[model samples]
Target: MHTFSRADFERFGQLYDIEFRFPAIHGDNSTDDYIVARGEITEHSLASGFRFTFSSLEVLEAYDSVSCGHAPLLVLVVLDGIVRLTLGSVEHELTPGTAVSMQLHPDYPLQAHQPEQQHLEIMALAFDPRRAKLGHVSPSLHGLTILPRMPLRQWKVPHALQQLLRTYAGLTMTGTQKNLVLEGVALQLAGLGLGSEEQESPDVPVVPVQQRQRLELVRQHLEFTPDHDHSLKDLAQMAAMSPSGLRAKFRAMYGVPVFDYLRKCRLQLAKHYLEQGFSVEQCANKVGYTHATNFSTAFRREFGFSPRQRTVDQKK
Candidate 1:
């Protein structure tokens, strides 16, 4: 995390024309200006070869009358005070320890209203979804996506994300390192958004007992023989189900499909082996890849870093 003193903040305020007021909306007498105190922008790279940005803003009694828009996904963490956010017909009242996310586009209008005698402190991160690799696997998240505003009590922030945010606040990182950190933050956020929903609601569907047994059997078989070149048909036969049924059931049970989960498990094993100082070829073979290049490509695609690059990053 980069720290900006008052002087540094003043310079930024002057540069960006901060504290400017806009016209009143709906005939309200309240002021429409925003006072930005401090902020920082940073980026991070992921093992999956993606880069993202993490940014934060500290403000006091900020208000936006004129609707402004953003292109990336915007996640706002309200640390203090109350902020009234209106998106389309929805109105979200955000308070301390609240998080609200929205897909920012040109058409959406966002207005902020802060009552007098109170200060609003918010930290926000914006990132492009295209570069985040969210679209490739989850087509439903391909476009602008907005997560409902949730209190911290309802949705617990993962420890990894919390640590990344802390690192963003203090680390004296270079541009490349910043990108890496941002990417890490994005990955963590995505995991939180996609992973937690299933665990939160038990009503969604579960695999039948027989199917669950088959899936567990397949996982155990993979663990026992990681190098086996088993096809979907073979796994489906082992599960006593058709390939399509297997895919659907696995996706319902887990967030990802069976093959994707298998690949991810293999890549995680490869990463562990690599971290233990195993050679690239050894890690590749241990993870069921016949060719080292194939493993390298898959590792990069999944984690945003090649095995060699990850090793170097781990050392650093």
Candidate 2:
């Protein structure tokens, strides 16, 4: 494992305007194991805003960290342990098997509170739009300007993809081979996290302006009011389209099934409430779930963790 010292961490703090607090060591001379408890952090820089970091640290004591930077994009995957993070104005408790993606700015840096006595393994990829060329970027990101902030996106990481990331992080190869592997991994992560892709040869059909506007209206309703009991028939009527047409066209426009998107929004809201000290039952009611059991099942499927895992105690 790579070794780091207190001095090294201090330097890092200075560079990133980050503040880190942990248990102080007694002796003047301290070893890596004594300093980090266990595991290590491996970082690889690809470009101005493109960086990959794999961290597997056994935290010995509870610690807090806050950092501010101007990176445009960040993709984080939690392989183990819970990550309590507050990005800008929102807070989230990330458990194992969950992945989160966010657009970040210098104004609202990521604040993290890491609990001790458990091993934490995570992989993070940071990229800047101005510094790198991201071809065929997602439509939502096109003409992207640096905004004050943006909401985060969360999802469950597939088991296969999780293993692939772990393999790439632990590779011991050096030189050209290692660089090539890391670059590939970074691209794959960008595609999954940022919704970027390669240019397609087929030309996409032009959507009518009114039709597109109607679809957007439905989308905004789902995002802003996820607590409502939404059905395809009802949503289609709101959009002035038939149910089947709404289903096919909404997926074509947004790249996700309509109800699937609604479920994600509902669960995301539920997770936020859970972190804010709401009980699972309350969260279920707030998210339009009549049955807490059904809501819990969907929440687990969406985030890969039990709803109770995000309680305030677990958040610690």
Candidate 2 TM-score, true structure as reference = 0.56
TM-score of each model, paired residue for residue: 0.39, 0.56
Kindly list the per-residue Cα lDDT of model 1 for residues 1-316, writing each as its tens digit: 3443434544544642333342332243332232333455554444343344444544433435323444335566555566676553224567666566554444445555655323445555554554444334245444333322221111345555555565555778766776566655665565454334545246546666667757756654554355568799998998899998878776666567777767876886788778777888998987789899999999999999899997787778
Clash number for each model: 21, 0
Of candidate 1, the 10-residue stretch with the lowest lDDT total is: 145-154
- Each prediction's RMSD over C-alphas, in Å, is 20.4, 9.0
Model 1 CA lDDT for position 190? 50
Compared with the true structure, all predictions reach lDDT values of 0.57, 0.73
Model 2 stretches astray by more than 4 angstroms: 1-6, 23-36, 47-49, 129-150, 195-316
Off-target runs (Cα >4 Å) in candidate 1 are: 1-62, 65-72, 115-120, 129-160, 163-167, 194-316
Displacement of residue 172 (Cα, Å) in model 1 is 2.1
Model 2 CA lDDT for position 51:
77
lDDT (Cα, 0-100) at 9 in candidate 2: 67
**Cα deviation of 151, candidate 1, in Å:** 17
